[model samples]
Target: MADQPEEVRRLLEAIDALAAIEDDATCASAVTALLNDWPTHHARLREIRQERVLALRDSGRTWKEIGDLLGGVHASRAQQIAKGLRGTKRPVKGADE
Candidate 1:
């Protein structure tokens, strides 16, 4: 849970609210709806993270510095996340598909 995002907290709240549903089928349906949307939610979180990375990079921070601020990943990994390198790489997958 150390690296969990803030969005997860909100999602947990939504899941918890499902407890009020008495019908099993209805409750399961609601839960499924929430779970199904997770990918989109995750992508949004990533987009926000990337924005922060760009802001940091614009402020003259190096990938190593960014990695340090982010959880200690390698510099190249940080660079890839912040500003994707050129080549024949595929586009990043978004939550909405």
Candidate 2:
């Protein structure tokens, strides 16, 4: 099935709303609403985001570049997530892999 642009808009709107909320409980509920309303959209969004990260790395871009292109997340965190998703045996510093 093809993804609709409106669905992505809705997901972004919902995330924006959640981020605007001050209370943790309200934020949680907002996220739940977003998940229930657009589970497939969120899943697709995640896939797209992951692909972007991978492509940035493949293009010889640094983790900082990838993170900046995707959003404002830290470079190290983006690198870690990318490595984990690719099943790389990254050093976890004692925690379970």
Candidate 3:
């Protein structure tokens, strides 16, 4: 969090607050809602990551370095993921239009 943007830090703090709920039924309901909407968030996050990966690639970062940053995924897989996301049209933040 020391290096993360303020928005990211706040979001994490909010999530942590939600996770700290003590009521059983409330927690269950919250978990249910999260699970129901998780796929949408998951997809959006993947799209964002793919855009970032492509931007990193364009900035001269090697595929291997990107793979290392992305949890040890192989360079080939990272390339494939980036290619797949090209059709999504989600641009990286602060990247060229």
lDDT of predicted model 2: 0.74
**Taking the tens digit of each residue's C-alpha lDDT, what string does model 3 give over 1-97?**
8887798899788788778999978987987898899999989988888899999999999999998887798888788778864334678888984
Report lDDT (CA) for all predictions: 0.80, 0.74, 0.84
Output the lDDT of residue 32, model 2.
84
Regions of candidate 1 where Cα sits further than 4 Å from its true position: 1-27, 84-97
Write candidate 1's Cα lDDT for 1-97 as tens digits.
4457787777666667797789999999988897799899878877887889899999999999999988897888778877644225677889458
Q: Estimate each model's TM-score.
A: 0.59, 0.46, 0.66
Regions more than 4 Å wrong, model 2: 1-37, 83-97
Pick by lDDT: 1 or 3, better one = 3
Query: What is the overall TM-score of model 2 with all chains considered together?
Result: 0.46
In what order do the candidates fall by TM-score, top score first? 3, 1, 2
Global CA lDDT computed for model 1: 0.80
- The C-alpha RMSD of each candidate to the native structure, in angstroms, is 7.2, 9.1, 11.7
Decreasing lDDT order of the candidates: 3, 1, 2
Point out the worst 10-residue segment of candidate 2 by lDDT.
80-89
Poorest lDDT segment (10 consecutive residues) of candidate 1: 82-91
